[model samples]
Target: MNRNDTPNGSPAAPQASFSLRQLSDADWARFGAGEIAYLRPVTVNGVHAIAIHGADGAPIGAAPNAELAVAAILQHEMAPVLLH
Candidate 1:
């Protein structure tokens, strides 16, 4: 009975280990420089906090909340990325 379970009752595979703190300042400078790709998004609540998942059919990272999650995935803190 995992939350990630699908309609057919199969479980989803785990995502990759990309962390926000792991990225250097320079990494932010070069994010999404070349091409464009689609990234799936998911939002979940933890015992003490809310989080967003980078589920581009795969996990890129998780954020403390929807706003930060969108920012991390989109690589920007612009107004359009806000979860409204």
Candidate 2:
């Protein structure tokens, strides 16, 4: 998700950061990198799992792998901005 901007076009608060509950090993593999970007938490089989939502707002899978990937992307991308 893109970050919110102020009226003057300066970066404002980041878009809401959402995360999945927790996911199964198999479901984690079903998700791809793109889907992981917008992952959210959801319940499955009475267990907590990471939920990957697409542009169409559909549940692609429970992507546990996304936790690290997303964080790495954010750290790499946002660190510069945050530091400055």
The lDDT values for all models are 0.45, 0.48
Model 1 earns a TM-score of 0.28
lDDT tens readout by residue for model 1, 1-84: 678987778997786688878888667545543322223344455333233322122234455555555556556432222222
Can you write out model 2's per-residue Cα lDDT over 1-84, one digit (the tens) per residue? Answer: 235777777888766565554656555655543433355556678876565444344543444555653565454342111100
Best by TM-score: 2
lDDT of 1 at 1: 65
Number of clashes recorded per candidate: 1, 6
By lDDT, the best candidate is 2
State residue 15's C-alpha deviation in candidate 1, in Å.
Answer: 36
